[model samples]
Target: MTETSTGGKGAPATRRLSAFLYRHDRLRLAGLLTPPILWLVVLYIGSLGVMLVSSLWGVDSFTGSLVKKVSWSNYHTLFTEPVYRTVALRTLGIAISVTLIDLVLALPLAFFISKVVQGRRWRYALLIMVTMPLWASYLVKGYAWRIMFDKGGVIDWMFAPLGLHGPGLGLTATVVALAYLWLPYMVLPIYAGLERLPESLLEASADLGASPLRTLRSVVFPLLVPSVVAGSIFTFSLTLGDYIMVKIVGGTTQMFANIVYDNVGVAGNLPFAAAAAVFPIVVILGYLLAVRRSGALENL
Candidate 1:
């Protein structure tokens, strides 16, 4: 090994790395993170704070300003009103269902990509196609969902000849559409985790007289908990936040996101809209925190 010019011989690499970080790379890395940090602060955190404040207040028409009473009336209305309760439950249900179905579809597909399949270029191409829906306008995507679930739409036509009569424009269609849209999000995270699993470990499982199913149950699934949790979080949170797709494909009586939109836009009750937004955040955050605390996140 080569010695340094200094009396200390082994510090050359460390000194070079420290210099590079301080002089060149550190600032660049910080710059890269700044925009996203700004976005989180200005857009996400700022909006959430404003909404929280609004949720605490009451709207009065004659006063034409929010009453700073900081009461639970808004939340109380959410629980006491049957319509609100039903819609909220429906929203939560749809989010959970979407997350689960996407997980079911993604796990096998990711396993295939990681274990059964080769030629990653083609596989990645197909993965990109699945996420292409995200590139389109969210409104257009919702409208596309509307087309698929319309009475004379392709979904109905496909099942019509079989005498199974497709019931379009409702909760079921909304769930299916959300699942279809979020499935890619689930797949990407799972694929990442699956791809990173060691090949030799799988071989070892096979050597232990474990069938493919058993190996998956004991070995693969355990290692994939983190990926599953992450993917489920994305799917659930996205569906919970989505109103446009549900509104386009669903009936007048729908979920909480729709209810929030109605209150803000149609009902002109900003405080209630603010209150409605809290349900999804509270539920989603609570679930994610639970998962993280339960040792599931560490596996990732």
Candidate 2:
């Protein structure tokens, strides 16, 4: 018989690699996760750490330049300065108002689209309508609202008959624009949660002689809390960090972000800007921790 060339003892490279991966699931998982993990740790967390360290440094009063001296001067200025305190509080209030407005507006519409709408086509159409605004430029949307809030703009024309006036470029206008911009963010998550709810649970509530309002109050609202919280997190954090909208719509009012921007650009105080930036980071982190304890993130 012939001496067969059995391709030696070693397996092909592809077969070897496949066998190795199959034998080591953890290795496969680590390979899959390495890119995202590196990005998050290096880009996001590393930048935050650098900012935090910079915030701890001091600034030169005469030259208006950053001083590398490690001290608590920046944070001390933030805490001791009355204007910083006022801006921080004002920003928090506006953020909360935007979140509440988005919640109230989104809840009813999300429920209607997810439950009340009959067919798949109609449901998708309504979803597209809800998401349509997101396709436009953020600056364009802000400027459009600015025009609408102008003295002789559409808002004034619409409510002129009622002897009312638009809020104009101020805190109220800022809140309105923020709420409008973030409404879709709130609606989509709530809609998804509502859609995933079981029809039988609602029917059981009805069969048990529960009123529609009672069914909603008892069966639906509790289940929706996590989704609402998730949406609020986005609306709250976005409003907190936004400077452009405030610049466009907030005439004289200054948010925390405005303070940071002014320090960086106008004042040429990098250390102070970094310090001012820390307040929003702390506030958001605390809010996230609170929501985490309430099991919101788990549900998400």
Candidate 3:
């Protein structure tokens, strides 16, 4: 009799709480969003804040100990040093090259998948194949590229008939590897954009006496800019911070990320590494702001 009485009282209390929550829509929304908001603020933004603060601290040159005092010596070195400038420029060039290569390759392929492919099964299978490379480990893909770029490897074997040879391990190989790694990031966005595009627009262009090439240039290209910008954000930012792919295939080519890795791991200078890390963050922020100003981010 006592257990039955307690259980009967608990049921009414649970009903009251659920009824209260259902009555207050704003409160319910806040309850749903609070966990993820807290997670983002504490983990992502908090780590970035810590890194920015650490970048201001100084390092002792002689003893290799942290100086604890704040200073701008690290940023000053990055600006004044010619080698740092060279590495920064090289990193930017590689990133831009990779973005352009992926853009060219993805445009035709994404169009085919979105517009020209006849059946649903064929389209899905091709999309899966485009993304299949991502299922493998990152290092595995890097080393695989290294092997193919090696002397007498698959690349050389393929080119032997044409009396040419592989570019071997260097900037050429690094760019090619980075391009292959990030191609899917570029493809999916463009494919989705193309899928959302109205076929009637293309029909109108054709009925108006526009050729397919002209229709693509005038009608399709303008509508796809936002997706292209979205895709470039992934490709460009990823290539900027990548160190491992360059390490495996870059040979003596030192990128901006390599400088940061060396400072922290090899030189034992955490302050300098944090400062070096700020460059890409700033660059990406600028790119995002520019995209926003152009109204492309709204569509995305």
Candidate 4:
């Protein structure tokens, strides 16, 4: 061994730092994770608990503060008021529709990217193309759709050559915008699942007498269930809470979250806003539970 190889003490600095970290500063390592943990407990969970408790609290006329009060009236109002039920259902329905449409599209796209595209660079390029839209702002995407859908805008002008002037844009355009915005969230997860699939299974299926369609159904689809579930959750949860898209495109048709946001910002009703805020989580959890109860949960 060469004594000069140590280079006059670069090694000792690293060793000393490592020894110091090991000897007396577990607290530093612990402190690194504490902020996110604290944020999860204090902000995420604490807010949910506050919302649940506040939803139970009745609105006081004089005090203008919701203090300790508990009753089922708010939830009852949610059910009895046809408008509330309709808005809530519309949000749920949109989420479900978007999720279904996303899966239908994403499955083929993901599978094609994973299996058909031969070159590594091209595969990555295609994936990045699909994913690049995700980096764009949600508000920007909504507004982009709005720009396209407006009369004399790109879509109307392009279709005018065929003498096809579409319905003047609003709710339908919003759904298209929202769907485009959330599609990548579904695609990425499913692509990850498909990309991780073992090539040997496909070989074995081919060795046996299964066609490509049968192999996918019998082998690939079952293995991809976790990704499917995860993608659905992403699309459903994101669509359920969308405000900018609904406000920009639908204009008058109120989504459940948009309604709550408007009540908080515009109408100045904190208690009712809290009640409405509770609605989306309940819908998300209900779907999650139902999906879990189904055989799809085996993926998890």
Candidate 1: pairs in clash: none
Summed backbone clashes in each candidate are 0, 0, 0, 0
Better of 2 and 3 by TM-score: 3
Model 4 lDDT tens row, 231-251: 988998988888878888786
By lDDT, the best candidate is 3
For every candidate in turn, the CA RMSD to the true structure comes to 6.4, 4.0, 3.0, 3.6
Ranking by TM-score: 3, 2, 4, 1
Residue runs of model 1 more than 4 Å from their true location after superposition? 1-38
Error of 1 at 115 (Å): 2.2
Q: lDDT for each of the candidates?
A: 0.85, 0.89, 0.94, 0.83
lDDT of 3 by residue, 1-300 (tens): 999999999998999988999999899999999999899999989988988899999878898888878889889999999999999999999999999999999999999999999999999999999999999999999999999998988988998999999888999999999999999999999999999999999999999999999999998988999889889999999999999999999999999999999998999999899999999999889988887898855654
Q: Kindly state the number of residue pairs that clash in model 1.
A: 0
Model 3 Cα RMSD, Å?
3.0
Cα deviation of 219 in candidate 1 (Å)? 0.7
> Can you give the TM-score per candidate against the true fold?
0.84, 0.91, 0.92, 0.86
Where is model 4 poorest over a 10-residue stretch in terms of lDDT? 166-175
Better of 2 and 4 by TM-score: 2
Candidate order by decreasing lDDT: 3, 2, 1, 4
Candidate maximizing TM-score: 3
**For candidate 2, lDDT tens digit of each residue in 196-249?**
899899999999999999999998988898888889888999999999998898
